[model samples]
Target: MNWDKRYKQNDKPWDKGAATPVLCELLNIAPQYFHPNTTALVLGCGLGHDVAILHAAGMVTTGLDISETALQMAREAYPDLGETWLMDDLFNMNSNETHYDLIWEHTCYCAIPPKKRQDYVNSVFSLLKPGAYFIGVFFTDTGQPPQVGPPFSTTRDQVFHNFAKKFQLVWEGKPSQCYPGRENREWVMIWRKP
Candidate 1:
């Protein structure tokens, strides 16, 4: 379960090496919503492609990950980002009542142990300003669970149900192209804090 070691070994199958297609589509379809200067946070930003893109577009972006190796790689790869790359467990993030306008949750939810799903939801909710938005992409599958997983699979209903208490589901759909291994299994979701 040493994620840093896995990244060091170049074993991250979840690292698509690019910004997610769904995120790109979101930016394209609603450019006004994803304003360049909006304060944004990205959870579990592995290689940081999304972080770099947001930074380049002028957002005050912060990328958080548990693995030092991944953070180092992200910093080195996008030195110009000048992003706040922090090595901290997402569940343990203490923003002290400060909230972000947008939170980009790409692969953090399903990657966590199932028992901690609610905590993840609560933590993210705690970090968002009232009426702020959260855009997430979750993986779904019908097969047996993997022996070891950072890319775990979850059902769409479960995700919606979990967030319903604290958020309103504004948009939910699937993008045309996901990374090779995730095609047909990703749900693009947009939720707004109440």
Candidate 2:
């Protein structure tokens, strides 16, 4: 998908204009899971809302996106946290560079083409420090055909197959809350790098 073009055209349907409801609820109910001053990276952080939420929770967060326009929008939306944004392809990030203590994923996994899902997992695994956490709110039942989309459909098995072996599963289940149409379609999972 031409993500930059989509952002340039303001065609982001996933741009919900606020932090994800599931993420907010997770942080609210389990603040102890996140340590203050720790580092975090938000993949496909379109408009920066979730990044802001992470920062507010005491994480030194960097919101990364493949689209410059999306990063621009994020900076405009949260000027005080302007420096928290980064523009780069998650898969292309140098594996030897700075690693993070936490990584947050929202729509990023679903947005990538299905063939690259394992690469996505590998890149995420490579980006974190040992014993760090990876928390994500994934679209497990998009109500679409498996062959269909940027917001592609995913199965429970696919999720576990890609991530469970390398990262120790800490928690997995339905999110406590979700966006209007997302009820029952999303799964919130937390994993720790072993």
Candidate 3:
């Protein structure tokens, strides 16, 4: 389904209504690494709760989602966030070279079609500065086929293998707690551009 329709109908089950606790915990643990003023980009930012968190922390934050409706709702809900909400596809992000220090990949990988997974990795690599990082959660569905998704089931091995050429998997582990339904199935990954 188109993302615009999903937002218009409020069909985004992926909207956790707040920033992912794993991301919050990571930032807290390594505040010096991901401090305020870091240039950050959040892909598939949905209603932008995490973007708001980044903005409040004083980062130069930009949020990109394909849906204009979602971006509008994000702006309305967080009027004071001062985030740059861009209506653009992640695969086609025309960002300048080495533009971001951090790329926050919440649910964008699983949301994309399986055939385009390589493109997703390439886009992330293209947007980040060398040695910059991508930090966030991903779902792993054991034995599930690629066609079964939006919250597609992905394996940790798949993610590592996909990014190995361009990124080094620096940190990875399951979170202490995930949002209601996503208990033990999520993996929080931190990948650095090499």
Off by over 4 Å in 2: none
Per-candidate TM vs. native? 0.92, 0.97, 0.93
Q: Over the full model, what C-alpha lDDT does candidate 3 score relative to the true structure?
A: 0.83
C-alpha lDDT of candidate 2 relative to the true structure: 0.90
lDDT of each: 0.83, 0.90, 0.83
Give the Cα error of residue 38 in candidate 1, in Å: 1.1
| True lDDT of residue 175, candidate 1 | 74
Ten residues in sequence with the least summed lDDT for candidate 1: 142-151
Ranking by lDDT: 2, 3, 1
**What TM-score quantifies how close candidate 2 is to the native fold?**
0.97
After TM-score superposition, what is the CA distance of residue 176 in candidate 1 from its true location, in Å?
2.0
Top-scoring candidate (TM-score):
2
Cα lDDT tens digits for candidate 3, 119-173: 9999998989898998868888523676786768788888888888789888899
How many pairs of residues collide in model 3?
A: 0
> Which 10-residue window in model 3 sums to the lowest lDDT?
141-150
Q: In model 2, where is the ten-residue run with the lowest total lDDT? A: 26-35
**Cα RMSD (angstroms) for every candidate in the order listed:** 1.9, 1.0, 1.8
